[model samples]
Target: MSARRPYTVRFRTPDNNTLENCFYATDAFQARLLAMEFNRYIKDHPNRIDKIFSAAQR
Candidate 1:
């Protein structure tokens, strides 16, 4: 296996706050998935605006 590098996933939260999350993955696909999941969680809750912030998943 290859070493996992720290990947950054940046997106605007539902509160209009730009957030950057660091993930360790071998490729961008995995990093994207992580970001998508996080974005999904941020959307699923209440009292927040839900929007697609991912490039592919959006």
Candidate 2:
């Protein structure tokens, strides 16, 4: 068995806004994988990205 670690997924808007969404992981590789997946998800969904930033108050 291995020890667990903490990780954070940061979602940033084009205008420099950021959101910290964290999770627990078992290793650095897992954390990096999660970040990549989240990034890919956002990239694949343009409308969602627009909506997320547009809905935010500037």
Candidate 3:
């Protein structure tokens, strides 16, 4: 397996509150996939993810 690094997921809640979360992943694409799966399990909002990026980028 590859080493993981910090990544950020930016999303908006149903209430319009923008939030960001940090996760560790091998790459940006994996980070995005992780966020999508996480969003699916959220009870209040299943489509909250707006974008994913390497922490270094934004």
Measured by TM-score, the strongest candidate is 3
Badly placed stretches (over 4 Å) of model 2 are: 38-58
Off by over 4 Å in 1: 38-58
Residues 1-58 of candidate 3 have per-residue lDDT tens digits of 9999999988887688888777799997787777766755332553677777887887
Candidate 1: residue 58 Cα off by (Å): 23
Candidate numbers, best lDDT first, in rank order: 3, 1, 2
Model 2 earns a TM-score of 0.45
Q: What C-alpha lDDT, on a 0 to 100 scale, does residue 20 get in candidate 2?
A: 52
Clashes of each: 0, 0, 0
Cα RMSDs, all models: 6.9, 9.8, 2.8
**Candidate 1 has what TM-score?**
0.55
**Please, what's the RMSD in Å of model 1?**
6.9
TM-score of each: 0.55, 0.45, 0.67
Please give the distance, in angstroms, between residue 18's alpha carbon in candidate 2 and its true position after superposition: 1.5
The Cα local distance difference test for each model comes to 0.58, 0.50, 0.76
